[model samples]
Target: MKPTSSLVWLRRDLRVFDHVALHQALQDSAVVHCVFVYDTTILDALPRRDRRVDFIHASIAEVAAELAELGGHLIVRHGDPATEIPALAAELGVGAVYCNHDYEPQALERDATVARTLRDAGRRFLSFKDQVIFEKSEVLSQTGGVFSVFTPYKNAWLKKLDADPSVLAPYHIEPHAARLAPPPSPAPALPTLAELGFEPSNLAELNIPTGMSGAARLFEDFLPRIAQYKDARDFPALKGPSYLSLHFRFGTLSVRHLVRTVRDVMARGAGGEGAPVWLAELIWREFYAMILFHNPHVVGGAFKPAYDAIQWETGPEADELFAAWCEGRTGYPLVDAAMAQLNQTGYMHNRLRMVTACFLIKDLGIDWRRGEAYFALHLNDFDLASNNGGWQWASSSGCDAQPYFRIFNPITQSQKFDASGKFIRRYLPQLKDLSDKEIHAPWLVPRMLPLDYPGPIVMHDEARKLTLERYEMVKKPGPSADQ
Candidate 1:
């Protein structure tokens, strides 16, 4: 039976078009109302000034404006989603409340509470897979178990896509536009940053785009260079990345749309290696999501339980080192510069993310969780699963992680990727006057040593040895030991 009235609850999937929950609600109801909640449970824990909050606020405004044009008004509420969603659904007398899935543990718990409350009221709470292409146990191994590694999982993902290409099809909502319901009363204004207990961030000055239009603008710019993604993606100085992570994180853009576009380009042989490489990245995201879903313990512990036994640096010295790393005062040009970019823009290049993360775990010998939490607080595109997976990968405590024995040489990495020192110079202007050769390690050039830049925090050679010893403690016993 069709519902006389249904409510569509918008979460990360912020856009109007190609949205599963919205389409589903419109399909089953004569009248559909849209809503977005500023969940204070999540917000109260964050700092007063956050770029993500600003970005979300701006995007919600866009959603409200767009919905108004579509003959519907968005109901913006500020409260715990668990209470707010059920309360709103009851007030609207909705037969069902539709929303997209959220994979995070906290979100799952919150949803469970909302579901119970809605069920008690005799209203249905329905959620659809709208974030990733495949979720939970969707793309399991042949043995019917969740795959831990990425490559095999990626292969399975590709095969599944090949077999069922319809998975990438967009959920067109325009046809059901006539079902949208106007606001019950005057549309409540979106809460201001101050009203929400958050100060204005530099998101506007950074010019990082927001909303569907902003996402489209970025995608249009990225399409031309996607063919070169494989070769250009590694160098931090170049405009290589799609810069759509924020869009993806917030669901301002649809994953299906991106995958479909890339798949079409690959079929035409226009994407070259870049298309497949970029597609693999998208798969990596799903892989992490699957990891988090299957192994929820990864939120607080290592994927390989044995890695938890490895002791990290402690006491005042360790805290001092971590502070240096966070402040961009570590004196390793590449690592420090990467931190500076993250602190200033709330964005860091992919290559730098690896280098910096490796430096934190391998060089500083600090706990990966510390760095992970720091990133969770700062990164505008912070998705818990991906961020946690990345930190674990760098710490050699994750599935398919880099071997602990193979530590990165910070100087060589800087020299190789930022060979011309363009990226370093951009972030670390103190070394701007130095030549490319000298910019990589200013300490090596005695004349440049005493410049504004601090000296190397710790000798790489010594740190590498310390890291090897630390990891050795967790090494399995040799054959002789058993004898």
Candidate 2:
């Protein structure tokens, strides 16, 4: 009797343990081969110095090395997966191909094409639910309808998880890893960042951990701090968040493992009040993923179609304001500092993401899509679903978004969340000497501002009034709807 051979292809899910498809492949097949393709379909659009590319390169290298030690070779390729995956499967003479599911529209299309090609050659193409605990219609409303609002969805999600804790179980690898197979003949070397047509980025200098070991280190560090997450996450200067989002985005860590550990900690009464709060945040990630899956139109248009009637600023002046907003020269200290953080480090704190997004959409009257595209290009943890959801939320155009009139005041948000301006000062050292109160609104004391720092580009009071007027069109679909 011949043993069944299968190929395990990797996408965002990079780790070898607690992996859905890998474990299933090992269980069903006698021999399993692993591969990671640096998909040219996606990478062709990215810049040469992208930290994301560098981070992924390092991660793939690590996974390949780890797999080799376990008696498997990760056949690395730098081409379109649609071609590379099928070609490799044929080369390895595998009976089936297995991988984790990808939800993005483009990824789905690519997967479909690959599935057809594999089926034509009489091979199985299998994908599994690995990233999210609940996906698609798993946590829908009682009436068998999709959830448009987050709170109700979150409630249902908790109910579903409480009903079945087995959803959080880890997919064991080491026990079955002896079935792993090295590449046929000689193993090809993993591609270097330079070899893949990318320049060396500052990922190492930024001190961002990469791969499985890095994820373990970050999770270990964040466990004790989970107790203070609820209270401390709002302040930018504090070490509050898990800072494991990048790992989540790239699948260096398992969200199921994180949630399970958090739950276990809470059950033992060692997780503190912050554990629940952090768990809620994790559910929010799932909520956004669910939204994107159900409402693909949100990618290009407003989720609430009626909000599309609201006109946005355009022409030369709007371009200037948008440029100013992007460069962190908006003359609002918190907004500017947040932009500076995003520009310099490819990271913007959660509180700051909202503040800066609101300033761009409401205060500057710019389209939220512009800001969304900017973040898509620059953010280290940029996920299509979450990024689109957040931008639309700020613009009051997403499902269950803030009311159109609920404009965020830059100064007030800064005073509330970043009270002492310690975070602002860290990014905008030009305003370091100002009193804590003064730093929140530097233009209030024009004489005190340095010659280099500019005054407020748009006054909050006046902008708020204009924003109200702009949003009035939503109440009555005006001519802007036709445009």
Q: Please report the candidate that would top TM-score against the real structure.
A: 1
User: Which stretches of model 1 miss by more than 4 angstroms?
Assistant: 448-450, 476-483
Over 259-301, each residue of candidate 2 has an lDDT whose tens digit, in order, gives 9999999999998889999999889889999999988999889
Clashing pairs in 1: none
- lDDT string for model 1 (250-272, tens) is 99999999999999899999997
TM-score, candidate number 2: 0.96
Task: Write down the lDDT of every candidate, Cα atoms only.
Answer: 0.91, 0.90
Query: Candidate 2: deviation at residue 232, Å?
Result: 0.5
lDDT of 2: 0.90
RMSD of 1: 3.0
Clashing pairs in 2: none
